[model samples]
Target: MLRVSIAQISPDGTKEENADKVEALIRMARGADLIVFPEYSLGARLEHADRLAEPVDGPLIRRLAAAARESGLAVIMGILESAEGGPYNSVVLMANGDAIVAHRKILLFDALGSIESRYVRPGNMPLTLVRLGEFTVGLATCFELRFPEIFRSLAAAGADLFVVPAAWYAGNLKEEQWLVSAASRAMENVAYLVAADSAARAFVGRSLVVNPWGHVELDLGKGERLVAWEISRDAVDEARSALPLIEMANQHMGTWARVRRIY
Candidate 1:
């Protein structure tokens, strides 16, 4: 069994304070094998995102990486990243004070009036699959949950888990749709789904972990807190064996089986 810790962060625009909260939570969840943090919980300088961005080796990420190394835990976290051209919304997979993988958000929510796209350059790379223990984990941001093809692609690439760091708004549509998406993603992909959400002033704080059988393993409250759960990889194998959606992945496969768009 693999234990996961979901850190529900409530940010006050102070990067140090947020980092301290995360660090405290990480220490509290000492026995966990993996720890997931919310997006932009460290702080957001919307107008000067490029200036505020940091590399994986920078202070913020380095601190988390250090904690992961000290605790012997794998960490999946979201942060604003600065590179050659500009900044981008990125998630890092880290262990032993080093980065294992970094995935940039491909689908920016610019059309939804989120100015994040204005500051962050859209990424062209596909979803990333990182090996953890006996399972492969897929990385994605909040908005990416609405796209089924993204999950399908990752599942096909042998992703057995999905980690989402989100900042969802406080509304019925957002809440309902997000829950639906989380459960559906787990049910369809037959993988474990862990969603860590920020508990901000105007956002909902329903951080959750859904199993391959679409069961809620853990659900955190809107208040700032850390929740943990243990999951077995055998559950994933069993779920897939029972409901073989993978076999039905491309029912429309013709002579051109490999050439098909994931509508």
Candidate 2:
């Protein structure tokens, strides 16, 4: 089993404040294998991404690496990752002094009266999955959850655990959709899924986990929280054997243009 924590906290402060919070969060997740943070967890708001974006190897990231290295833990968190043209709504994973852009949001959030493309550039990176002990962890961002193709691509590439971090907007049925989408993705792929969403006033704060069998294992309702759960690879195996849906439907599931794997 792998212990994973979701830092369901909003990035509603300055860069230094957010970075400090991240360090404190690492300290809080002392015993967990990995921790996941919501999208825009460093930028006070998505609108500020243009001005606040930082390179993968920038000082801010190096500081984050130092924190992770000190804690001897790994973390997945959203950042306004600097790139050509503009920033990418990117999620970075840091472990043992190594950090990489796990996945850039290929599908930007442009619906529900919000156009993320205004400041955020669409990512062309392939699907990224990480190896943690016995499980392959898939990483994706907020808006990507609406598209099952990305999750399916991760599963097709041998992912057993999926992580999604989001700044999901609050709207009529939006919360319901967030819950359903997270669970549906896990069920269809027979993989465990952990989704962390911003707890800010504008976004839904219901961070959740769905087991390999598509059961809601934990639901962190409304507000900042650091919750952890142990996920089993054996459960994924059992779900595949009992359901047999992935084998039958994988061929039809759309694939990403490319795929990348990391340790």
- lDDT of candidate 1 at residue 179, scale 0 to 100: 88
What does the lDDT read for residue 73 in candidate 1?
Answer: 89
Q: What lDDT score goes with residue 243 in model 2?
A: 84
What lDDT, from 0 to 1, does candidate 1 have?
0.81
TM-score of each: 0.91, 0.93
lDDT of each: 0.81, 0.87
Give candidate 1 regions above 4 Å deviation.
250-263
Candidate 2, residue 33: lDDT = 88
| Candidate 2 Cα outliers beyond 4 Å, as residue runs | 251-263
Least lDDT summed over 10 consecutive residues: which range in candidate 2? 249-258
State the number of backbone clashes in model 1.
0
- RMSD of candidates 1 onward, in order: 3.0, 5.9
> Candidate 1, TM-score vs. the true structure?
0.91
